[model samples]
Target: MLGAIVGDIIGSAYEFNNTKRKEFHLFTPKSKFTDDTVMTLAVARWLCGDKEHRKETLVRHMQELGRRYPTAGYGGSFMRWLHNPEPQPYNSYGNGSAMRVSPVAFYAHSLQEALGLAKISAEVTHNHPEGIKGAQAIASSIYLARHGATKREIKSYAEEQFHYDLSPQLDDIRPTYSYDMSCQNTVPQALLAFLEGANFEDVIRIAVSLGGDSDTIAAMAGSIAQAFYGIPQNLASYCYALLTPYLRTILNKFEESIGVLTPDPFDIERFIKAQNDDNTYQQALKEILQGHKTSHWIWYIFPQLKGLGHSTYSQYYGLADTDEARTFLANPCLNERLREITNALLIYKDRNIERLMGSSIDALKLKSSMTLFDAISPNDIFSKVLDVFYDGKKDRNTLQIISKTFNGHISNN
Candidate 1:
């Protein structure tokens, strides 16, 4: 959990750095926690509550904390769900799972129980499969790490279990947000950040530098790193005053359940134990962890986030980077034109109006359509939105034609 805290602080500083180097203050008077911390507190608070149905516990706690900390960036769909007379989950699969999964990992008596609780807690808000998968992956990794799994063992299991491409390199993820948001992508990457890390601070630097969902990715990676690496003496020593009097008590409650953790330092042996004859393990390892490759947008997006105001994140924070602009997009309603290829193909591939002439799917339902034009107007919103996005200098019809042609490369049916 403190890993999440440290990740929050570390990434808080360099969220847009795109590439990482460890040279900065660990936390600041302005280095406050985000929804990542608040929701984590919610999960931790409820896991220790009455042994009621896990979903009920989660809803109650999430609702309570969300109201208590209404200002922290929350996904919009979730916020709407929160105020509705009867809350029902919107099938969202954002990075919320990765951020709030640690409490179960440390608290569960066994692996199965930890996984079960992680699943239940995830479903309370994120009904989407990818969301559930992402949460489970993070919690399981935390469980393995706490129970004495080595970095190699954790990486191997994550790769084998989820088929993640676990490359530890962070040079490419910056400036864009296009990686898969599923456990297959998000969890393993976060773990690899810790697995390849040298210490608590290293974990955050690696995660934020890797980009994609920078803050959440770093926060998730940090949560796991805390357990594997243990809190830094310097950090815990100095973190005392960062919290409000309220959080100080919360930390004590957080520690109360620490007694139940049962780490089995030998789990790593299980991986190597197969080394005796399982020739297949090597091939499997290669297949899953082949390349932890990432793209370049991870670098650019950080600057965009930090540069949103008169102060760049680095300038405002008096640190290298600390932008919180993307927090507004937490609502899950505002679509960033960015997406993982898998998700893009699933939700937006042919939904565009450009494809109406070339494809069969409904074009009116495209999110871009909603953003571009209101149906109340007879004018084609698609053409108008294109004109605006590109400036009125370009022909609206020509832009629509261009969008269709480019979209064809990605759409087959």
Candidate 2:
């Protein structure tokens, strides 16, 4: 649920001023929660508040929250329903249904419960078939992800059950996609972004890069990504900080109700001071970006990587600890270009940490990303990196510069 809210806030700035590029800042001065966060919290409150799961309860919460955050960029029809004395299902097919449905996934113990609850949540206003389907599809994907289903299995289930064509890659979808609010147009693209992403942050970046209803698309994708690949601690802290106290209180209750302990946000001042105190944090980033894959820096930094649930990135990747992460990073067969791109990804991850810190990610997320980076074929990694950092357009000069810089470093060594 926080993952969805994080995406909403990050993409909020870019929703109106759409940027097809993924290199933009994750947050800005203008960034804030929108209708997506408000309605999502409403659904969450309904799930946690009402033991009977009544539709009337859902409607009341939605109306109350919506009225409180009236300028949250809600669609006109939904706004009318929020204020109406006799609100009814408007039979709308908007992506709003999918954006707010993530909480149902976290609250459900089984896939069927997820689908059923998703239906109840959507029908309050979006009684249209696509709206219900959209909600169910996202809810089911997140449920499957949390239950340890592989991406392939989740993709097959969504394709077979929801009949969404998850086959189209983001590279193919980004060039021609436009501003679309309908569930049919929004849900599939969001799901596809999740399917193609390398990590949780990667998924958000991919969804935002698609450039249509950016926040909702990223929100839907981020929810599933969080289920599949748990969010980094730094990112989670940023998410919590951007939210209101009431929203955070509801979020805390919702998580507690589901048997999940809400993580406390890191003290930014202390975190920044820790970074300044540890020279290896900066040194590791510098050496890795310079194309030297030393295991000692990784070992040094792993101890400082404090996270919420999982301890280290290696563990997240199913390995034991920093030793396993080091072994994974020391892949012998990666060609020159693949190694350079891997270094570039490490640099990219470092930048994300800097941005979020205002500053080490749980370096576990970074290590796990590298572990996955090593597992994928070189071609796919190259394509994904270009799509993300280079905006899906392969700029040979950039690759050439990375290669040359790496070669220069090797010669100096």
Candidate 3:
């Protein structure tokens, strides 16, 4: 998966320049992740979200991520499909389907499973027969490479199954190949590059030297190369450094969820420290108060502190003691809603915690257990104003004044 992202970034600069030689620097200042990396990460995220690998899940996640990154160099038709209120396959035969199917290889346990998942991954956008075939071929090659199949065996199987012409050498293909996006044209060349390369880097270089759709081809080849050669530590680190923190976090979570290796507790501590150092908590709180959506950093980080003893919570919040921390944690209404909001955010349900908080308050109106004022302790108007403010239905200044006054009352009580 990292290999595919690295390859995309490496080839991004040359995608338009059409370099036919492998002598170009692997990483340049202009290098960036494109649609290929985005969709690949989306697939990994979707897979991590559930135990079942359903087509609807793939479609939903892909569209969600796609909408998040509108200028990710997606094909025009595909972009339209992504934004459609009711998204359906547009019958694309483009290589976008194959470039993003790399994660299918890692998630499947058997060749049959890989092929089935590959089909499901592609048919959501690229349901054309050639598109489906291209994805299957790339995924099967990756599956075989990971399971220790030799290059000759992989080539033989791809040829027999997908009828891709893999006989041409890189030397022969480099001179004449031009930019092409069709799955039939690109997948075989990318596979050939993988089949002939000595290592992961060699595979990317060979794929780029073909000089057509450089990033997508290299991304396809890199996926196979990663399975066979395993990415070097230095290269993997370099690639990871190029990703945004959000993408890196998803990659880490996806890898962890898929049994790539349990994260070291020390590494997790380091991650927490990094988040704290970045003032992630302060930013999340500000966003909540200002009626903006906060990142999932809060959802992930708060849970670690939540279930710990009140002493730990006090330490986390710089409170004076366990009793002081309990002012917030001991409030059943607030605590229950916080848990629900955290779960919802983890699954990408509601982006705004403030909105979710307000919804929880509204739901209280229909419940017999308690009203918001009763839950928050006998401040009826204060509770209603808090709900309205958090829901973005009232003035910010009024909300702040009320919030401060309410906080003072709670503290005195």
Alpha-carbon lDDT, every model: 0.55, 0.72, 0.69
- In candidate 1, what are the lDDT values of residues 34-130, reduced to their tens digit? 6777788788888777466468767887887777666666667878876766787778787787688888887788989888888888888787887
Best by lDDT: 2
For lDDT, candidate 1 versus 3, the one ahead is: 3
Alpha-carbon runs more than 4 Å astray in model 3: 262-413
Task: Show pairs that collide, candidate 3.
Answer: none
Q: Which candidate is the best by TM-score?
A: 2
Worst window of 10 by summed lDDT in candidate 1: 317-326
The local distance difference test score of model 1 is: 0.55
Estimate, for each residue in 212-326, the C-alpha lDDT of model 3 and write its tens digit. Answer: 8999999999999999998866456556544544566678888887688623311223334534667765565454454444354432233222112234322232211222223
lDDT of model 1 at position 363: 22
Q: 1 or 2: which has the higher TM-score? A: 2
Q: Judge candidate 1 at residue 48 and give its lDDT.
A: 75
Error of 3 at 208 (Å): 0.9
